[model samples]
Target chain A: MSGLRITTAAEGTTHRVVLTGELDHETAPELERTLARLPQAAGHRLVIDLSGLALCDSSGLTTFIVARERALAAGTGFELTAPPPPVSRMLRVTGLDRVLLARHPQDA
Target chain B: MSVAGHQVEEPEDREASFSALLEDSMEDLYDNAPCGYLSTLLDGEIAKVNATLLTWLGYRREDLVGRRSFADLLSVGGKLYHETHYAPMLRMHGEARELALDLVTADGHRLPVLVTATVKKNQDGDPLLVRITVFDARERRAYERELLRARREAERERERLQRLTSTLQRTLLPAELPEVLGLEIAAHYHAASSDQVGGDFYDVFPLDADRWGFFLGDVCGKGPQAAVLTSLTRYTLRAAAVHDTDPVAVLSTLNSVLRQRHDPGAPRFCTVVFGLLQPDGDDFAVSLASGGHPPPLVIRADGEVDVLTTPGGQLVGALPDAHFVATSARLTPGDVLVLYTDGLTEARRADGLMLGEDEERLPALAAGFAGTGARAVVDSLAEVLTAWADEPSDDTAILALGPRPPEAR
Candidate 1:
């Protein structure tokens, strides 16, 4: 079985989600649902930590984009942290790296 | 009196001993059954467990009998799932059958197992205890993992193949349409399917300082085979146009090359319209030749639409000496000349009517587009195509060329 683990930690107004696993079409929905359930209040910061993520596919990228859009609509800050090399390369190839990548919470 | 007493005593002692032996074996059978068995309190605390289960889990009776709940032995994900879904379902249904779970043994190893559990109730129907039976599922789990890996590998291979097809399709067409002096030009290519490369192609390039060559064509089929023919036809047309600017000569050259490469078992052919444009004052002198392709539509500067007739044409590369027809027209300022593949004409609407089958519909449609710039004409046609109920049934390539007004030039 493909292993996926999601752990959410809340620090004041910032919500950080750490992900570890292969994120393909099968598991992308799990991440989507997790993000969708997060509190969407103005000025709330949502950070996805990808330091432990081993793999990601196009569907996973789409989920991240959707989360970013939702955050923007809700007037919240959103960003991705420490995406693995493969995931970063995919974003670059699709020309979304600069638009979607946020190095720090303040940057977002 | 002594002999009767001895026989009676022996028979009574044997019957008592046989009854005690049967009672001892019944308890042993429950502990040594092939499958693991356990009984948990209503709250999932282990109340009693058999020897078979204790051995499989590598746990001593004292370590688990009243110490740990069943949920504690599961993996983190399994625990979460059990709490959120399994436990609630079991409570509502009173039984959960053949649930697959990963158990963490005392040695920290994972053991996949299939578990069946039922709630045992007292005579008053109040739930009293839960009984569970577990079967080792190592072999089944391994088989399932293999199947999943195979499916994932197949999907990856398919994605790679699609990327390759798209890259090859891009190489078959010009990177950008050539800009001719004093003329406005635009082009669009609509692919009927993304899974395979389409056979439609178009190009506009300078033939000389004073003239330009353009062509739009469709191969007989789709996919890799037709893709090969498309590339070959495009290269041959470009090379022939360089050698001779005559529209008919350019097509005849492609015809001979295709005929030479044709296989008898799987004959290949295409329909093409080759044209040459030369600047003439504030207009362009256009010479076009057709090989079993649709005629070009000229939307005049005064909002009059006319189909340039190039009759007596035959399908290219089908025969050694196929005939082609050449026609000439002058595209004045504000007059757009549109060249397209049969995909446009053959497109079927939701009601099953072909766009090209009704000649009146096409001319009437072009009438609305008369006096529009080349870019507008191409863009509007693309929009019209997108409005179809389904993707165009075939690859469609459209190229429009028109002269610029004197002030713009």
Candidate 2:
């Protein structure tokens, strides 16, 4: 069981990261610890590539929501891309797509 | 001679010794029974096990005593799950009871068993090694499988019953809308839920070609009684339309039939909108009679959307002479008339916000149509509804009549 490994890279003003393996109850704290260390830049966009994510329950979602709020408070753009079907569906069911400004804006 | 006389006393001693031997055998049963009995250190390691159990698993006392953990005995999936999820829970709660696991036997057969584990502690309530008990669950697994099969059969039976009811419910509506000249017409019904019956019904049939009679109604309550009223209203309207093309007179007859058939104590009433459409050359003129139903929505070719209010109309069957209000509209080319039940407006979102269909409805519809035909209108209406409702509605229905474009032929 591999814990979530977040690999970050800098592309000009945008901060891109990829999350891999399970994001769940006990392991969410580890993700938050990694998120807190990030430097905040005004208008910095955070694009999370979730293509390698295996599973995520409610705790993991709450972590993302909290992360999104922190980024938005600094007036920065935060968006996720390539979420697996399970995570994407959870976002849709919870109406996170509308709040987070996910892809396919017109449909939302 | 004296020693021979003491033989009875000797026999009593022998009986006492036999009882002592039985106690020794019982102690041996708990320690080295046919099944495994092992206690481990604070971290799972072989502490003690029955000789028979050791032989069955092909593990030596020296091989497992200080090295092998209980998790080591588990299959790969089970071991991984235990380390990631189960072990932590056990540490926090002091127990991991009746967890089903598979172990590799000496002959390489997967031995299925139910394991119960508990953490032992010292006087200071400190942690200790986990003590585990395993019970064979193959028979229980077979029993559970049988129960699952029975549950599936019961569910299938229920689905069949609902389908039959749905088919019977569908048969109670008109087969097709009568093709009224000089007008493009389309209608739809969106069921709030599939499991229960819906009383909302709509139809458009000719009161003799030139005059077309269309009715949309919601019978009070649900189930077979509402179904009965729906069937009665349709037949009575069809029969009365032949004699009287007047929309108000047609409803008056429906009122009488419902009043006569219903007992005074019974609750019987329905909201209906009956329209008489007549082609005046190339234009269409509609005279609508309403009985406590939502007024039709007119989406003009000019792209203006408004809810037509048909006030002062009484619900049918509730009054001796239900006062039906009559309103007239001249439908221009590219214009569409939508007569629907209140079900559409009343659908609740996840946040308990009722989707104000009349107000916020057009934007979604306008988006659905890239400025074109009735087909887009119908498709958009369904898409927006499924989006808003999220799931099948608690009680929602819609009926739209759109005019098609002339050029495509």
User: Could you say which candidate leads in TM-score?
Assistant: 1
Chain A of candidate 1 compared with the true chain A, TM-score: 0.90
Which portions of model 2 show Cα errors greater than 4 Å?
A1-108, B1-96, B101-113, B117-131, B135-147, B263-266, B303-308, B349-351, B356-388, B392-395, B402-409
Assess candidate 2 and give its lDDT. Answer: 0.69
| Shift in Å, residue B68, candidate 2 | 16
What's the DockQ for every one of the candidates?
0.01, 0.01
Q: Rate the local accuracy (lDDT) of all candidates.
A: 0.82, 0.69
Query: Candidate 1: which stretches are off by over 4 Å?
Result: A1-108, B1-35, B50-52
Angstrom error of the Cα, residue A3, model 2: value is 45
Write model 1 residue lDDT over B119-201, tens digit each, in one string: 99999999999999988899999999999999999999989988998898899889988778789999998888777999889
Candidate 1 interface RMSD value: 21.8
DockQ of candidate 1 against the true complex: 0.01
